[model samples]
Target: MTGEPSSMFEAIYAGAEAGEAKPPWDYGAPRPQLVEWAEARDLAGGGREALVVGCGYGADAEFLALLGFRTTGFDFAPTAIAAARRMYPASKVNYLVADVLDLPRKWQRRFDLVVESLTVQSMPPEQHTAAAQNIAALVAPEGTLLVLATTRDEGSEVKGPPWPLTRAELEEFASGGLILRGVERIESGTWWRAELSRGAGGSTSHARQF
Candidate 1:
């Protein structure tokens, strides 16, 4: 039998049902830094497909769809997915209730861009490595994996629905044999965004210069 619903999940479902939903991490818009990086690039053009992991209420997914990418969004919580669907009834985004860990092997290397935002840090400590592998597998050859995550330098242990990541933890993608192309830190004097990527070949790379 499935385990009883967690309090966090229950709250999300109730909020959705009551029309009072608000994601804790909701920034009211696609993270401004992400918007800048994505818009500056030539990634989303001419009907490309992009995948969004941990799409809470479809804010980012909505923006991607408007930008011309056929977007698909996944979140583990059903309530959030429902709200997202209603919020974008005419949207082409294929929002679904699915856990990142439970993603099928057949989905490997399937997207032109894998846009992950804070999803990796939400996992339990022991699951971090596997999560990296999953994210890497979703990116096609020559495709870009634009990641936006929080980095902690204090070596603090994370007890959370949002586990903080460190530089060392970010490097775990290389262990899965991904070639990091670049990493850029987005500091708006408020939040930090670490954007990491991997090339098709097996070589680790960084792009902190952006």
Candidate 2:
């Protein structure tokens, strides 16, 4: 079972259930960084598996299905999952209400591609590494992981339920034998897009669920 809801994010989308605005991060479209990366690499899933962590409203998840992936996108917030299903009733993407902190055992190292954008930053700094580990653990052998986040200097101060991540924090995604392949700062260093890959047959047993 998934853990408890993210009260902050839950409240935000809960407002949407009452006909209020979606949270700022819900772009109603796929993440541009992910599209660019996939397009440039000529990445095509061709029925391969993909997972999107903290998939708020299912935009990225639906986008992957268009590229031929058997995609599963999940969010901790029940409201968010409901919104996704409501938004894309005919979509092939599987939208689930699941928490990154508590994933199913069958998911370990099971996805050919994993896309995670902005989800880690929504969590507090204390949970960053654990979130990273779980996200990384979902990648299959020889598969790839893509991560995007709002960027900030390590010592920078900001008032937030959405704390922008530092470079070191982004690096934490290379867990359980996943290699940090490349990293780029975009929009004048205000955003981070990172690509990581796991060596085929490497162990993902180091990952833990809490």
Candidate 3:
């Protein structure tokens, strides 16, 4: 999320344009965890607004839209947004180019559900705090924030475009009035899945799952 944002994303999309294989995180489908969550909840009511951060091909965003949420997916790369729109021409999801660290002011607390899947890990360590703050800021009061990221053991020396996040680092998202509802290690411990809510009153309402 730091550095010259355009340069970082331009180089990435440029590689894709050159016929290189898509990045590892570009799974070409909605993330399984998101699918599961959607199936478990009544999110298809057409009454909620959802935002997917760094939404590469907008698969997840499109999925949310299909399920009746007014979904918007954004990425730092304009190429990615264009590709997403083209890929899902019939999709109701709104695809746009936007930065997580410097989001539009009107978007502040505008979504009912904010999803950050693998986006935090894509940035350098120095940008994690700012990225977390900005991401949390997008959640409306009582909205849910779902995060899925690669996880690393404490003190592990892993070099990466995706510097795997530690458990403690993920907890930092709980700052700025977001309450941690739960954290789970999934996919054979390679990923950390967290669900947080924005509100002062504590409740365990999210414990239900299908």
Candidate 4:
């Protein structure tokens, strides 16, 4: 973690410039744990809009749209955005190319379900707070933020575009006024699903069939 690049932005941009195809992060299918969690929680039907960060290829965004949420998928890579638009055309999903740190301020408090699947941890360690804050800002008061990402095992070093988070790191990322509601592991525990609400109030939880 220490000697790794101080930020992922540079690497992402370099990949874009070099036209790197099939970045390891683009796993073809929507991450299963994320898909399963979203389907099970009825999060896609939540009243407000949803924003999918690091939406490479947009399989997750399409899935979210199919579940009835107005979805906005954004990535810094134009190639990825183009691919996403092509893949999800005629669907009600909006795909754009943008940096997560510089999103329009108007988007603040704009979403009910904010999906941060495999995104935050992809940034360098220095970016965790900013990523967390940005995700938190997008959640409307009384909205939910669903997080699905890989976590580092105990005593492991963090070096990555997929910089895995430890449970403590995950908790810290969600610390800015968002309360954790539920947690579950996926695929032999390589990934995790966490549902968080903006404030402390309704603790009720249930899964929705997709």
Candidate 5:
């Protein structure tokens, strides 16, 4: 994973600098699955601190902000961060260019709600543990983390910069006292959304939705 994760995304977003092209996952709107979660009030972040990992173009972060969360979205790619700011002029989200492998210490266990969607799978399998741990570390005590990602059956083969995570890989995020509440497999098992929580506190009200 040496230099691969950071460079791959930064390069892809760089190609979209013209505004005519956007990363394949950037649909110009918040992801529908995430929107549904918010609309259902499954994720209620009223004035809570929220962090959006690998928030390319800021759609999800903006959506969380509108949900009344103090949201911060970050991408390792500078181009993506800049484009997000341009796209959401006067947005409440704090868009930043920061690395997942090396986040600021102040951010450790600082978010009441952390959203990680398809970001960990961007790295190679060798780095999945590190990526998951870093992401899990952002959840404050009793806080919740939502992970939405493409999934593949264990031992299945795939070729991708954005590789689909195996269940084993996804479970890595539950380390360090994080509880794996439930996992919802969607779209014929090709996609999954998982909910997790930290500390002795209970999971989110929508834990059953997972």
Candidate 6:
């Protein structure tokens, strides 16, 4: 990670300047799994507060906003946030530039639903735990955290950027007073999706559909 862009912001900013499409996990659309979850839970018109982590081009944030959630999308890259705002000019989602590891203190426990898609795996392996802790800190007392990331078997060999997380690593997000409600494998087992709840009193309502 030396000499090369060590942080996501640097990498993405360079990619954007180079006119690359999908820079890193852009996917060009909202995640289908998220759509399914939203539909299953009838999130539309629900008016819940939502936060989108590393909200690349705002697709996921826009989706949540369209569903009546007051969505806020943040990314470490200024270019990414700018592009997201431009891509969805008519959207109500608030797009901002912010680091996942050191988010605004006021944002702690501020959202009812925190959506993290591929954001955790984008960081260096050494930073994964800190990223997870920061992510968990964003959930409200009774909020839900939805995590979607690439997965690898324990002790698997690592390649390059987009290091895949193991099941145990994903479950570790439940630390810091959060509880793991459910874990599912999606995209033909290439991905690990988990639902965690904060202070839900053992209720699995948000994860029951999975």
lDDT string, candidate 5, 10-50, tens digits: 87788778555668888788888788777766676669899
Q: Candidate 4 residues 26-71, lDDT tens each? A: 6787877777676565554643477888887898888888777888
Clashes of 3: 0
Model 3 residue 133 lDDT? 87
Candidate 4 at residue 160, lDDT?
Answer: 69
Candidate 4 Cα misplacement greater than 4 A, ranges: 1-21, 42-47, 200-210
Q: For candidate 6, lDDT tens digit of each residue in 113-199?
A: 999998888888888898999998888777889999988999998975778899878987887777888789988999887888877
- Per-model TM-score on C-alpha atoms: 0.83, 0.92, 0.89, 0.80, 0.90, 0.89
Segments in model 6 whose C-alpha atoms lie over 4 Å from true places: 1-14, 200-210
Pull out the clashing pairs in model 3: none
lDDT of 2 by residue, 107-204 (tens): 99999889999998988878999999999989888788989999989899877668888999999998889888889998788899988887667654
- TM-score: model 2 vs. ground truth: 0.92
Best model number under TM-score: 2
How high is the CA lDDT of each candidate model?
0.71, 0.87, 0.83, 0.72, 0.84, 0.82
Error of 2 at 169 (Å): 0.8
Better of 3 and 4 by TM-score: 3
Q: Which stretches of candidate 3 lie over 4 Å from their true place?
A: 1-6, 200-210
- lDDT score for candidate 2 against the true structure: 0.87
The all-Cα superposition gives candidate 1 an RMSD in Å to the true structure of 3.7
Between candidates 1 and 3, the one scoring higher on TM-score is 3
lDDT of 3 by residue, 103-153 (tens): 999998788788899888888888998898899888877788989998999
The ten-residue window of minimal lDDT in model 4 covers: 201-210
Q: Compute the lDDT of residue 63 as modeled in candidate 2.
A: 91
